[model samples]
Target: MLPPSVVKDRVGRTLDRMTSQNIDALILFSREDIRYLAAFDQACICLVIPKEGNPTALGLWLDIDEARRQSWVQDTRGFVPQYHLRIGGGEAQRRRLVEVLIEKGLSRGRIGIERGLLTLEMFDTLKSGLPEAVFVDATPVLKGLRIVKSKEEVELIRRASEIADCAMEAVSQITDVGRKESDLAAEAEYVIRRSGGEVLSKTLVGSGKRTLCAHPFPTEKTLEREDLVYIDIHPSYKGYHSDLCRTFLLGRDATKEKAHETLVAAQRATFEATAPGIDPEQIYKAGISSIESSIYGRNFLELYGHGTGLNVEEPPMITKGCREKIDENMTISFFQGALTMPGSYGLRIEDTGVVTKKGVKLFTRYPTDLLR
Candidate 1:
């Protein structure tokens, strides 16, 4: 279903914050955020900005049907009434937005935008087009609101996790010797979406040293007795996604078995360390406790985990140097990396966890043990 209430509350909160931040308007570009506001089903370029009377969205003629739906939008209209087709001329979109901003009195006020997603070319275009506008960094403000999940959002994510768990279960049952990594990945995807999962990303089923490479795509790598097979799935259900990683023993890998035991311990430590108000560094330490300190000292290139919500990645990072406190209702991913020599296997066991007032709750329920 459409997230009308979430958008409504979000819009209300955003307008309140805009008043305090002195932001007159925000022009959004990403589809996810646009979907959140417009509640549209189709994907097309659209613009949304706050104004004196109501928020406005502008789209090409192709998205007229979707824009008219107004799932979360209070008001919307097509860019040109006469034009019955989509146009992508850089100059045309720029001029229309400038005119809208000027009419809304936002030409000289603070205009919010996403700096990372918006290109430098587009930034220059907006700047050159609207010389009087004072652009403000709205990323932080919007991120703050999105980091915490509402009850409804959490429910949707839980539903996604359930579907992912079913996919993993099916994959485990059908997987055996003589099967290729790609075959297993296909089975997982097939079972997952058929059982109501929306496949948001491609699956990863790497074997042996291939597992050492994070996000290794499905390949024809044959199974080996002493090979460590790792499968990771990032799935979306009801528009909420779950990113999970699990390991498997192709035949009888002694190194993989030992690594699995160590990783299980490390994951347990990480889970135990996670709770509302706890420092995220403490969680990272737990993830690395089972391994040697030198490994983390020299090879810690990525974050321990990150918050997950509407998108695969969310704000309020769970990593070192980040002080974003874990609050109740915040949903986050708990991931542990596997980087070492010898067998060259990376063991990452991740789950969607929610922060509660007293403790943390994991949405994923699959067993962590790898077959020997």
Candidate 2:
């Protein structure tokens, strides 16, 4: 859980952005945005944040008690859902949300909504309920506020990265010949859970030829000698996520060993290119230049990386054509890899870090060397 002051600061920044954009109130639909504002972590809950008043949270009757206890908002309301409605199950709930908005004197004012997350049916219902109110897309405003991380948020991300490191260490110690990839993945997840961290994404474990694919899931395939194995772990603490990936080898192979070395160099170049006042596109170019200087350059993939914080992928993307400048206290995940050829083994190295005045401060500290 975050401190009261930290939560207040987050809400204050959001309110400031809303004022600048002339938005009277914001109706949040995504769980991430709601949790970030009110510290509530439940589903089917709607949050209404006014520009100058205390925020309100609307939830089901069964979850109102928990919402009141967990969320920082003072005005929490409950509504009973009528499942008998065949067209839409939550008509009653939606009507309650609109009623609350109107009661708050926002019926004729401009309302901000998450267009990407809202369903077409819900949008229609809201439009019909508040015909005078103008609905404006607030996705950019929300993303702008969330792009920079505060001191407390950075600490949570650091702790999440530490948990990922522990899980990867467990993977390195328990992996052996003839062991199933699924078994290793399960062990890694257990390690994260035991350390009081939640698994944000599936624990990806790929070995041998399966490593060619970027996002392969663990399978029943048995490990063999000289096979290359890689694992990607995403774990979270207090809603802050960390992305980490590392590669290993069952036995020694010169070609794969060289590729691992090149990938590490590319990752280092990316880290060196990251700092305050630098464009993210420059960082991506630096990484590509470093990779192309190696023998495995032609095998490099196009996808680079992106920002990581409340969500696994966020703003200030580290890719081509992104003109966003990297600012201090921004957290980003850097990934660079290469496949020798189609259907052939590959190697990748990724880590999460925070941008600083000088350079990036890495959170994931697991060794990147290919395991023998």
Candidate 3:
């Protein structure tokens, strides 16, 4: 959990943005956004942040007490019947939210909402309840505010990276010929969970032909000699996410080793080229140029990296034509590699890091060597 001062600063910054947009109030529904501002870990129905007063978090009756205990928000409420015992939990919560908005004098005022995340039911309720209010999308505003990491956020991400590194090391030790791809995934997951971390996304273990497939999950297929296997681990500590991937060659093969070397070179080039004020597109170009010089250049993947923190993939995605500036304090998951052949084999390497005045400070410190 972040300090109360950090949460206050975040809410203050959000309120500033809201005032600039002339929004009378802001409604947050997504768990990510809600947790960002409130530190409420459980699923919630609504979190209303007015322009002048404290924010209100509305959740299910069962989780309301936990919400109060966990979040910095003081005005947490649970579902209660408006008049009789007829309304359901969802409707009751929406009704209470509308009342709160009305009480705060925002019933017919300009409101900001996460249009991309809100469900159709919540949208309809808000529109009908506050017929004269204008709903502006707050997706960009919210995303923009979280692009740069605070010192606390960076530390959580760093710890998560260490967890990923441990998982990768465990996977490397057990990866051998005849082992099931699922076994590697199991070991990685066990290490992460035992380390007080969570696997919130796919535990990818792609081997042989499966390496060509994007975001492939582990299966029961057994590993064989001279096959390429890639393990992508996603782990989170205290709501912060980190991604790390390493490719392994089951048996020594010169062609596969060279392919892995090209990936490492590309990753290194991308890292060396990264700095504050750099264009994300330039980073992509540098990585692609490194790959183009290799034998497997034709099979290069388009993406070079992405911003990572609360989520696995975030803004300022490093790709061709991306215009977002690479700023200091931004956490990035620098990744590059490509398929050696269409249906034969592929290799990839990834690590998490933070952008500093000097360059990207890598968080995941596991070696990128192709484990045998």
Q: Each candidate's lDDT (Cα)?
A: 0.71, 0.84, 0.84
Ten-residue segment with the worst summed lDDT in candidate 2? 80-89
Q: How badly does each model clash, as a count of residue pairs?
A: 0, 0, 0
Question: Runs in model 2 with CA error above 4 Å?
Answer: 1-4, 81-89
Q: Is candidate 1 or candidate 3 better by lDDT?
A: 3
The TM-score of predicted model 2 comes to 0.94
What's the distance in Å from true for residue 81, model 2?
4.6
Q: Clashing pairs in model 1?
A: none
lDDT of model 1, residue 288: 67
lDDT of 3 by residue, 184-291 (tens): 999999999999998888799988899987877899999998888989998999889999999998878887787778889889999999999989989998998888
lDDT for predicted candidate 3 compared with the true structure: 0.84
Which 10 residues in a row give candidate 3 its minimum summed lDDT? 80-89
Model 1, 1-372: lDDT tens digits are: 356566668777877877777777887776666655556645445555674556666666667666676555645556564432123336666567666677777768788887666666667767887887888787755668777788888888888888778888877876677778888899889988798887777888887788767678988877777666788887887667887778877676665566567666766777788888877787777676655543333433343788776677776677777777778888877774665453566666677778888677888888987884
TM-score of each: 0.88, 0.94, 0.93
